[model samples]
Target: MEELGISLSFSRPRVSNDNAFAESIFSSIFSVREWVDQFIAWYNTEHRHSGIKYVTPNQRHFGLADDICEIRRSTYEEAKRKHPKRWSRHIKSWQQPEIVKINHPRPIKSVEA
Candidate 1:
């Protein structure tokens, strides 16, 4: 495998070796006509993923996310002011995350002294 340049994947202690994520990304392309054009368009333009605060990719791409978030924040503030009892805790953060990541490294456990 090493000579053939194929990377190996296997479970080790405390390390994830699951290939599901890597494998699932592959789309079957039987030719140009059968390619996933519609899905790709919708996924990028229309789909509002929860990870991105429910904003479409195009909105984030064009730097409109901040304005959108601010609008939502203001709306929430007004709602809170009118109906204080509706929120038991602080309003949700409408700010987009500073960074988005996939397969992010997990915090390492520190051994106690």
Candidate 2:
């Protein structure tokens, strides 16, 4: 970033809080196991970046901030609902042992093998 004149600053390596904002954005984008390029395109055009004061990165770069907050909120909620089981497991596994032990149904052994 410094190379592009976006002066870089960070805390000690082991402490991630200093870069929490960037980390959160990355996690949101990369957590899905589907088309990453589509996600990137959507993230660039739609996701509201909180570090940029709830304005989308695209909006901030283009000076266009309208109902980005609502759009982002709705989109995030839609994504969560679209993958309820995965999202629920992600949020609950750390706190619920039964949830963690819910084994995914295994595929049958191949007869040819």
Per-model TM-score on C-alpha atoms: 0.62, 0.27
Cα RMSD, model 1: 15.3
In angstroms, the error of model 1 at 90 is 0.8
Best by lDDT: 1
Clashes of each: 0, 0
Give the alpha carbon lDDT tens digit for every residue of 1-113 in model 2. Answer: 54577544556544537888888888887766457877887887888654454555677566454454456556666777888765743321111111212256778988884
lDDT for every model?
0.79, 0.58
- Residue 65 of candidate 1: its Cα lDDT? 85
- Model 1, 9-90: lDDT tens digits are 6544334447655655543333443557777789789998677788988888889988998999999999999999999998
Candidate 1 residue pairs that clash: none
